[model samples]
Target chain A: MTETSHAIRIEDRDDPRIAAYRDVRERDLIGRQGCFIAEGEVVLRVLLGGARFDLDSILIAANRLDGLQPLLASVPRHVPVYAAASPVMDAVVGFHIHRGILAVGRIGAPLMADDLLTSLPPRALVLALVGIANHDNMGGIFRNAAAFGVNAVFLDDTSCDPLYRKAVRVSVGGCLKIPFARIGSAEVLVDALAAHGVAAYALSPSGTTDLSDLVPAAQSALLLGAEGPGLPHEVLQRAHTVRISMADGFDSLNVATSSGIALHALRAKSFPLT
Target chain B: MTETSHAIRIEDRDDPRIAAYRDVRERDLIGRQGCFIAEGEVVLRVLLGGARFDLDSILIAANRLDGLQPLLASVPRHVPVYAAASPVMDAVVGFHIHRGILAVGRIGAPLMADDLLTSLPPRALVLALVGIANHDNMGGIFRNAAAFGVNAVFLDDTSCDPLYRKAVRVSVGGCLKIPFARIGSAEVLVDALAAHGVAAYALSPSGTTDLSDLVPAAQSALLLGAEGPGLPHEVLQRAHTVRISMADGFDSLNVATSSGIALHALRAKSFPLT
Candidate 1:
């Protein structure tokens, strides 16, 4: 049973309190005033469970509140919980939300790339990305990073915002859980990583050592680029080049897949197969 | 300059010759009559470069024809090439044709799972998939197979058709080049592989042996399931249960990424770590 005291029933789709949730696809692009939308039960749980992001409000379909009772109970009573009928919810969002759970949260203060790097504990694994503009790939990378224990993600400007709605959903709330900050250009990011005593490996189709042969340093970062252009030439020159040792003629693997494989390989560095 | 002899200009979007290329997104669902559309330049090149699929026709935008001259010259004279103005091309497809190159080809005769097994050379690697409904995942799997030298791919009946347009596009033409066949159910497919002296391994999070520790036989097949409800319980029981040994309290890696890592590990088995 939902705690009715904390809930506000919304009969009007145009209610002012729920304005942040209206026309979500468009608002995702223009209306993000330092606040981002967390969709689905899992992401909402992540937003409320952690102190990293402050919950602004939650707009949930009436039917879904019953199923989400346990999760809702966990939400701080001070936060507003707005409930809408399923049809009104669809009209407000301009599309049918199959998941039917949504929350708005302030992303908190800006985290500088340097601060993110400084925060990493020794013997950390980091995923450094350049030109990863595709939302799905970014989300997948974050999900992989969390699964394989990446300490944090450092992104160049060319990469998409991990806080983007689609990316948050695709990450399975990983973007919310994992710590990430957009640094400057690829060069600046790598230089900062080096300054912090983190060795970086640029993952490419052409590299000196097979990915399986990479021996991770006490602090390691795997530099990745978008699919087509791959890492810039200068960036590859700056870091140790690593290849996955694929068959001669085939094209390179997807960046997200390659990163996952590379992270797993590097993580295995500490284990040293007996 | 485009070769003018074989090219027919299409002023009308409704030109019957270009019928196969109309409203592709919808037609992909109900109208794939043993034939499929290949989108973009690279996939079109792969479609023409290989004989496994017969070219039914070629459609090109007037502007793009010049750059695709060499590719067009390679097409058999009997295969008619249709050219439309950019606007006509867009109207025909019901969406902007960004790459502006498309081809339709017959998928060729059906190959049975047993036939695919018998056709493999000695010391082969096969990727057997169950419930792989996502097109992008299917495409990524095929690309990985091509990269790591997977001899062929076997899919259970529940898996989506690899010839779906999105799957082909995502594969970056791997679907065109790599040989795949849908064999009955998961049990039947695994049984056939066992009969062929091929060792089968089901990848799961709870497997007994770490993926890094598995030894590959002369002929090996890695069985993978869809993301949510991994390979069925009975199937895991029958095969040697193998896992990637992920970090504690994290989800399993993406199915496509898992397959790539598993394939790489088995591929490395022949070169055991010293």
Candidate 2:
């Protein structure tokens, strides 16, 4: 745990000293495998505070190392810390850099849907996403889900990966904290939820049943669709279609925004004001 | 009233046949001057159905003209109709498109905050945005505002214009349906709301009061800031601070998503359940 084992300095972008940080954009397009990048001090601090993942390395511009010294000092002495000039760091990352601090961390192995469900308490809330490809929406949903006390999130096959850089960044690192599982399909999840006696609610603008009337159950799953096509007819049929009433003449709200509203409304009944 | 006065067909993208559809992205960035574009059939229909704005022209792909014949038949004979081949239309619009239709409408004169406030009914709900420059967020806020029965919206000096193409498109034409005004600053708007005897509620993650307590105000103005920086300290101090209670350890919701949840929570009190 000496200084030689903990810190490395690089002056060149292609120095192989920081191979983990190269081709970030291209890697992102292909789904960043093995590891995900956490940007900004706040997000990295959150990750460091949580036990969900192992940090691989820390990267900071040499000019900014003094500012992050206290944070670096707190990490395990064995963790590798790398510093580069600002321009070299930016060239390696393939984007104009602003946050100055970054962390490369190993993505933990995926969890099974059953494991996620079983880990929750009896009165648990979960999000079931369908066809939500937008990374921002996926991230926002996770952030909302965590804020509203949702026990876990289950992404249907069609949804985007929550660990994607943009999703993780947009989630403000909530993706790392929240327990999420990716299932093969909505049909399989619906059957599993039914077997577990969890009431499933499909969020639909055209739903006949008012969402407010449905009491929050001990275990409930909220299903959401993409912005445009909405939940497929079969998926809606499998769920108890519930609508958050809107003022007449307005179209449906954005899927992620609607998910936030729904989570807030549904979660309120279960979690009383503290 | 003749066919010649209404429908015009052009085979070339540069024929000057659809000047209204040219440089739409540039116009959006430059404040759109005197016009706004509504793309897709659904958005165009929403605009046509709403009484908030006047239509300047309608453009349909030549191959899809039959689909809109009924709508064309219903419109006033004075409005011009333009048709072009799908390729020509895409070239003119500077993007690949769908729904084979578009509409160009003159921008309505901006509404005055005082006028809109005076016209609002007792117990009216309104959204007051401060320093939210993201166009998509602006549009999403308007859509949420419209959906949750918010009577009007007031934008502070720092917000982007909601009429910009991306905003308008993201709003799904709700920007046209909702009444909105731009005020000079949050301070001025806070004072004005106080003068009108409306309760001003500033939404923040660190708010001292729960949002549920502020819903019963006879007239309320919900103040929101952009994501990250939140409401300016001065603005937060001037308005009653209210927070949407969240599960511990989670960060704040997305600004637009938070607005939706806040509006829905506040509006739920007045929702008529059958």
Candidate 3:
């Protein structure tokens, strides 16, 4: 780690400066002020890209310094890189973090819904998430959102924070690459998109139109919600309701799967599915 | 609760006959013999449908018996219905199962891939999984497979068991609805589909053809592998290589997302994308 000569060596679990990374599970319950944790090698690499969040600091197991040295080049010089042994890392985290990689990054001022919708290009496929609280579902939806070439993402205020540690990990850092904003409600987000000429296709088990029958516009957004209760009835009433055909009524697709399928359907159509 | 008068109360955790319900986390390691546990009320209802496997027994928190009574009517009279207090149930399962629902059932004889493939209808969409070891991916893939009207699922020998507790729960018992079988290798599964006049499309990040361009056949199969390694080269060579267009090279879709998107693409094409 010769290139990282300025790295700080964390010798004790009581280091007050590294407080943000302590007892993450407990800290997750209460807010992290304006800081969020990014874990594992992949997310750290994306964080080092410095595109989305500003890095506060990074901490990795001492043994990993050599392996990660190449990727650490882009990390800003002033941001402290804390290296600790596995024992200290485990002690501070309050669990055996097998990944042995962690980074603290500052969340920027929250993006507002209407301002974000107005800024997108005329040709865009947006993904609007509403009331999706499960971290895994949030991560999976964002992962698909990025992969399917979504121009931007809109999450309702009720949605789980995509920056939650597990969401970041599950998204494989894909969430970091995409621009996202949250609004007051699903209605506000959907209405804002409409004002910007983005057609909303709300997914539901009882949707009137099969996804295949729905034509994709130049600007379209697939509106999604949590698994069980699904999109709010009022929200579904406003947007064009669409559904993926299933084998039977025995089960419905997971919310993330709906995101992938619906986004693909919308994207493929705009590309002129021939 | 009145409808479930047949429920047997379990007060002790050490009863020898209830050994199968003991320490599920430990049992998952050594194997559950032929017995697999289905957790949560949704899965328990699916288990009681009596379509695939016979119900060995059901053990739910005693308080749940009343709530689950309507659904429990499907349980065969011959099968045992065991109800235990929350503490006793947690002690036996070695964890606090907040879902408070579990059912043990035999995993019948394994279905050979060749038999399952050859038995499918002429117009079929099959999902072939190769070297997918993650349980979440396994469950997610199965859940999507069911949603997209996949005719069957084929797992290569190296794939993780979809019946594992977490996978089963993650699948929302959709894995239970889907008829799946394992084969010796990806090569064998792809070749078997070929023999049945099914066109195989292997999904890879660096594939030759875009997914939208690949025409779906009367009988088609989408072959997928793990996220990082992806489909094997030999297997890719055997089938048509297709890739989903992504925003950039920084990230790829999760395998479950890949399955959902690919299956929808294939399914939508046959209905003739308008």
Give the best candidate by TM-score.
1
lDDT tens string, model 3, A8-61?
A: 899999999888889999998897999889888888887777557898999888
The TM-score of predicted model 1 comes to 0.95
* lDDT, candidate 1, A46-116, per-residue tens: 67767388898998889888788778888887889999998999999999989888899888887788888
If both were scored by DockQ, which would come out higher, candidate 2 or candidate 3? 2
Model 3 residue B64 lDDT score: 86
Model 1 misplaced stretches (Cα beyond 4 Å): A1-6, A271-274, B1-3, B271-274
Instruction: Report residue A199 deviation for candidate 1 (angstroms).
Output: 0.8
DockQ for every model, please. 0.51, 0.60, 0.54
Q: Report the CA-based lDDT of candidate 3 relative to the real structure.
A: 0.84
Which candidate model has the greater DockQ, 1 or 3?
3
Which residue pairs does candidate 1 place in steric collision?
Answer: none
Error of 2 at A71 (Å): 3.2
User: Candidate 2 docking: what grade?
Assistant: medium
- Residue-wise C-alpha lDDT for candidate 3, range B107-179, written one tens digit per residue: 9897777788778886788888999999999999988876776778988999999999889888888778788
- Collision pairs in model 2: none
Q: Residue B134 in candidate 2 has what lDDT?
A: 95
Over 4 Å off, model 3? A1-3, A271-274, B1-3, B195-197, B271-274
Give the range of the ten consecutive residues with the poorest summed lDDT in model 2 chain B.
Answer: B1-10
DockQ of 1: 0.51
Question: By lDDT, highest first, what's the ranking?
Answer: 1, 3, 2
Chain A only: list TM-scores of all candidates. 0.95, 0.92, 0.94
